[model samples]
Target: MTTRNVRFVGGPLDGRVQDLRDHEAVAGRLLKHIHLHDGPKIETQYELHYTPENGWVYFLCGTQP
Candidate 1:
């Protein structure tokens, strides 16, 4: 399947570009990202929003316990 480059904005994933399935690249898509800083169990959720200026922006959805 073809993939598209999606840009992430805000939070820890800011300034990162990731390739996602074409169908999964739509706006309002939520991404669950787990980050292990000093230890495991740290996770964050981000939602994708489309903007003419910034394209797909992943805004922080808050941390999960």
Candidate 2:
């Protein structure tokens, strides 16, 4: 059974975090979506902060200005 349902928000990964059983799976997905770029872009990198609250596993980061 899944440990819990993670709800992603405030970035490209604005959806429910799936595949909770696999660490690699979650990491891979986060890496892909968190960057906000689906394509292969080496420059696509940002600081991610895990701030789970109110039964939600979401994040908050500075947007591009």
lDDT values of the candidates? 0.80, 0.42
Over the stretch 1-65, how does candidate 2's per-residue lDDT look in tens digits? 44555556655556646443434324323333334256543322223333444442545343433
Per-residue lDDT over 1-65 for candidate 1, one digit per residue giving the tens place of the 0 to 100 score: 98767777677888899887778867888899988778777788999887788766678888888
Q: Which pairs of residues have clashing backbones in candidate 2?
A: none
Best TM-score goes to which candidate?
1
Model 1's alpha-carbon lDDT is 0.80
Runs with alpha carbons beyond 4 Å of true place in candidate 1: none
The local lDDT score (0 to 100) that residue 8 gets in candidate 2 is 60
Looking at model 1, report the run of 10 residues with the lowest lDDT sum: 3-12
Residue 4 lDDT, candidate 1, scale 0-100: 63
Off by over 4 Å in 2: 19-53, 63-65
